[model samples]
Target: MSNKPLTYLAFIILVLGGGLLIGANTMPGDWYQSLAKPAFNPPNWVFAPVWSILYVLIGVVGARTWLAFRRSMAMRLWFAQLVLNFAWSPLFFGLRDPMSAMIVILGLLVSIIGFIAASWRQDRTAALLFLPYLAWIAFASALNAAILVLN
Candidate 1:
């Protein structure tokens, strides 16, 4: 009776469920609506679906890292990025501080890149799984920077 499936399930729930819970609690609301957005700003409706998909990928990658590299730098970066990821919405929307959110997002971006690099040789599949996440975060970091400049 391998517990691997249960481990995968738990990791998926942790990442996806936690992200959704945090997102629900930190809805942008009227405050974000008031901000001067960049021309590239995505419609509000695009966020949920994108994040839902990304979170699932993130969860799977996270589980793979956990199972193979629990004591490695990839695992540490995974945790670091998750904390930063979970903090971004609250700092940005809930506290209405784009500056802090930008900082957090930058940290998240760095941690994500570090995770990819760390896991590349050790767990190439895990590293590969993070590519879309990397691209999205890069776009998001740009968006965060644009909002900071615009507003």
Candidate 2:
């Protein structure tokens, strides 16, 4: 095992932060509570726990890729998805614009899919971890679209 402590720590932080960044916009007293959500929208309590778990998985998948392929395309795609993931928080919750958030989420969805595909090429386990995230985002995108149209 490599004793690259700092590198490992950085990867851990990246994964956790990347995961947190996804639901950064969905908190109470933010745009989320203000909006008239679809009846199908999940209860607010469901988000945090789900996202926290996903964050851990995101970190694991990233670590797996780094372990398996080091500095390869998987790493690049991972970074791409992370950047895209970070952007969603400000767009949705911070700005409180469902339309804008929708666009950002759609773009993020694409990047995540790309990340999944790229990660899949190197590590199937890592790619599988991203699947739930992708599906959740898809569901979120639909909810966002509904809010945009309804509001």
Give the best candidate by TM-score. 1
- Candidate 2: regions farther than 4 A off: 4-9, 18-26
Tens-digit lDDT track for model 1 on 95-128? 9999999999999999999999999999899999
Residue 48 in model 1: lDDT: 95
Q: Residues 26-116, candidate 2, lDDT per residue (tens digit)?
A: 4446446777888889987897888777777677777777777878887777777777677776777767766777888888788778878
- What's the TM-score of every candidate structure? 0.98, 0.83
How far residue 7's Cα lies from its native spot in candidate 2, in Å, is 4.9
Q: What are the clashing pairs of model 1?
A: none
User: Model 1 RMSD to the real structure?
Assistant: 0.7
